[model samples]
Target: MKLDARSAARILRDPGALRVILLHGDDTGLVRERARTAALAVAPDLDDPFRVAVLDRDAPERLEEEVFALSLTGGRRVVWVRDATDAMTAPLKHCLGQASDTLVIIEAPGLTARSRLRTLVEGHAEAAAIACYPEEGRALEASIRQMLAAEEIRIDPDALSWFAGLLGPDRAATRGEVEKLALYAGRGGQLSLDDVRACIGDAAGVSLEDAAFAATAGDRAAADTAIERALAEGTSPIAIARSLLSHLHRLRRARLAMDSGQSRTDAMRALRPPVFFKRTEAFGQALSLWTADRLMDAAEQTQSLELDCKQTGAPDLTLCRRHIARLAGTAMMLRRDR
Candidate 1:
């Protein structure tokens, strides 16, 4: 059956008689983490080759055999199938309804609801499909708060709201940021708005946002400064590109709202995280400068640049700089036309 978040988490701690556990979603980090949790519940040492079997997509005949095969160590075993897909349906199907102490864990990151593997697992009584999407809004805030609370730390409401926006979509990345905050606060401490800014403002996420805003507002020097700092701080150029893409996507939303007769301020207000107060003026400028079509083109350009950055021998930093220059130049041209 398909498991809710609570049920899925509970199962990882105590998976009784479950033949196959499918963790699928866009949040690959969460999926991998949960998979390891569930597997560790069965086999205490997942690194032990005798008790755990890790398989890739196009693997040998070990999958079905590993599912039912008794471990040499004489304990419950774990079979981890990474990057699973609809193609894995038949292999996993054969394991269902059979009596075995082995647990089959599948990590499928991009499976849709109509996916055959998902349908099959949810249909079975002895199997489960768990979705691991990224947390957002109140959910994200609560998660950060709960995590810190466990560490005996408290974050002020405003700081929590701002901190939530700094987190990325990846669950592991979000947890890393939370851990940083926890360490910053120490035990039995509180995080205020100023503290949050001091801790995370210099982070790559914020720096990337700074670069993105500078580029979109036609501030070439500022964009270059932020971009160089981000790269020098060990952030990959692709991450910088994605940050730009995210900014453009946000602009696309606001532009659509403006197209529907909402004022730019209204469109900004409609944003979930709201424009960070510091970026409010530049945000407004970008909104005013770019038409909806121009924002679409810039978003596409950034997306392609991200893919290009992945190519071997590519000058990723140089390419990223050029892309930022283009964005700034375009914004300038739009401003002149206005």
Candidate 2:
């Protein structure tokens, strides 16, 4: 049977006799969390020398033997295989055949309809194949609400939606961010949009990232405000400089791709989302004027700014602002030169 991540409660309530559950996903954190939860449900004591086996995929042929040993122990045992791949096919099949009332949990990378391992688990009478993909749209919105509720943290619907969107692609990161935000909010309190914005959205790390995007797009005003916001929110200057350098380094590569006859669409396909959309227009405008050399120059300037922020005793915020101003100025000159 295939299971949804959120439906674990319902599924676990009535686990099948096979007791062999394979929880797989790109999100290893979530996969491990589920496996841990399930294992504890069966064997609450981890240090009791009980019937519980946690096998890393890197382990040798010991996994198959471990499964068999744990199963025959008579007591209900849970064996979870982490970082599983195609190499575990033979071992997994062998264990499944001799489950002996033991629960075997396997975590693999994200699987598709064509995945052979997924097919095997789904086809089994007693086994379940749970697919754990990054949630989005309604699924993500619902998950954010559910996760907050679990932590006894209430969020307004609007704030919930905002966090859901902000947390794109990484469920584990989202969970951690929510936990931090909840801690910041304190006990017996609800988290507001301002809390979300303050803790997660407008955080120094997040702001620095935004500033880099703004700078790359030649939006000096936005970049300046983002830097100021980051600093005001207690973001370290060195961290902001490092983030800026990283963004510029990526931008330089995208610009080079454009220079190499790759169309904007193709280049955008290669670039990560939001970054691609945010800079698509600016990059197009930039391509009309700035040569690869100019972009490389900007990248080098970013590196220099990073080094200066780290090595020099100069105030970090001022150094970053000055470097940003110079970069914007250079971009303006390049734009005019076109």
Candidate 3:
């Protein structure tokens, strides 16, 4: 019942007569969205009180009652439990033990992997558990394109990459930004870099992305300025570390493609989320400078930076700044030698 992305999509739509479906993860936006999808699958009209029931957290005992209740309207019933916690595990376990056609969709965002509810549902044959986390890399880029396309809008490739960075770890916020941008672009209008800046450009996400790329491209001053701007904008140290790790992992993938004998142009083209068009030349230079092994090393360093940032009383900003400086120096030395 442990669901990855592909299987999760299938299950959300069909659910295959599952009595209970649990959606849990750190990305509350994704969890909520998926929960809504699951609910709508069974009960199309959430407003219909008889067909769809929302469980009140204050009364966890109502879960079983809601699930067992038959619809007077003569269709499948859906019970939505929002802001679910471990306290509901016992109640959920009880409901899943019974026989009912009602679909119980649980939204337990930020649940730990080993949480009792997840363990129970994932282990159960009649129940399924889906972990909804934030999309990243290609997945995120594809989602952005899909959203824009849905609105009959097109974004320039470089602008798409920049806007992707500005999007989110939160699907809700991403949707909001996309909606705002779509409104700005209107129906047949195309989006440019200028358009992106004009709408939803104040986000610190792009600054963090800039810091990572600048550090890897040996632009120390640009890297410093980006890092400072991101910090000034209140970007968390851990978030910056995660951004650096994302860039390193991306480079590692591109390096792997090259090592497989693909031409540099083909390899870059094959990159997930595709490198921003403006960074193409620098990305190619970085590929030449950073071997696969070096990219892996950089990823490890970025991981360590995240760990350090999590420690109590750690000088997270200082540590993150120093890490970027070291990366910039490494990029410079590698470029000089190459």
Candidate 4:
């Protein structure tokens, strides 16, 4: 049996008495989502310990015994095995044969149509297979609209068209971006075309903003490369400064929005330039270590540095490089302070 992510939720709630439920997908998010569903469904009471058994596919030798043990354990038991490679096929098959009432959720990537595992699961009466792939076109748009609706946000068709172009194909990434757009709208508003443009801007702005984030996160190697590339493409020092300022401003706004009753997804949308949806978690991680005050201070410092670069006879490239390095170090320093 095959199912998509939407159907997985329903399956979890009323998962029939299958001896084994194999949840496999190429997309990491789908596999994890399904596995999580299985885990939670079998052990809805999180306090219960012995009801769930987790194993790695690499350790399939132990899986059969675990299957036998869990099948006899009280209520529904889950045996979750991750990273099922070809070498473990025999052991997995043995375990599947022995598994009685236990729900065996296996997470595997790189399984082709002709793969042995695929054949085994499809043939097994007790097992079900699910494919998790990147969304496209109408499917992608529908998901975006659904997520926005959840936050009480509406986007005009024009804005939705532009918004779709700016998002990544991954489900998590798509969900993340819409969340940013929604929160940016706040309560009772439609996401406009202008909002989408301002949030992600053109390709150049996207690259610069992503580079600035890399710098702020202490990835100096990536920061150096991204900064150099932007500079080579005629991105002005003032423009780079303004971009960082925009990022800082939004980080501050996102922090404030989060402090209010809004969710992080909403807070991200509330941000000025709108941090990419995929980056919300990183921004959240950044929040605990730094504050709006600190981010504003960094921006002010960058402004001063920019002024110094303008007033000096120093080489423009050299001065720009120095300031970007400093912006990159700000988060590290703030993290140390805490």
**Per-residue CA lDDT of candidate 1, range 1-338, in tens?**
98998798789999998888999987887898899889988888878998999999776356889888778878888999999878888777776756777888999997988999999999998888899987777887887888899989998886887677556567787788888888899999999887888888778778788889998998888988988887787666766776788789888899899999998889999985578778899999998888889899999989899889878799988999899888988888888888
TM-score of each: 0.68, 0.59, 0.71, 0.52
- Residue 200 error, candidate 3, Å: 3.5
**Which parts of model 3 have CA positions greater than 4 angstroms off?**
56-58, 72-74, 192-194, 209-238, 245-300, 307-338
* Tens-digit lDDT track of model 3 for 116-187: 888888899888888877787679888888889987899997777767765547788778788888999998
Per-residue lDDT of 1-338 in model 2, one digit per residue for the tens? 77665566556545647566777775666676677767777777755455877778787377776665643445677777878776676766776776367677788865557777777888887788876765666787787777667767788765665455445345666677778877877766698766777777544566776676666656689778888887786655655655665566556666678878887557656753224344466555545545667667777777777677666466767888887777666666666665
State which candidate, 2 or 3, has the greater lDDT.
Answer: 3
Error (Å) of candidate 4 at residue 308 is 46
Q: Mind giving the per-residue lDDT tens digits that candidate 4 earns over 1-338?
A: 66666775677656686655565554576567667767777777545557777777668787777776743347777777887766656766886666376777777866777777777777876767777665655676787887788778888776775466444434555565666777778867787777876765644446566667776765667678877877775665655665666566667777777777787777777654455566666677666666667777877877776666556475767776877787667766767777
Q: Which parts of model 2 are misplaced by more than 4 Å?
A: 4-9, 12-16, 70-75, 110-113, 201-205, 208-338
Candidate 4: pairs in clash: 176-277, 177-277, 180-269, 183-266, 183-269, 183-270, 184-269, 184-270
Please list the C-alpha lDDT of all candidates, in the order they appear.
Answer: 0.85, 0.67, 0.85, 0.68
- Counting clashing residue pairs in each candidate, in order, gives 0, 0, 1, 8
Model 1: CA > 4 A from native: 48-50, 71-75, 112-114, 212-218, 224-338
Ranking by lDDT: 3, 1, 4, 2
Ranking of models by TM-score: 3, 1, 2, 4
Which window of 10 residues has the lowest lDDT sum in candidate 2?
Answer: 271-280
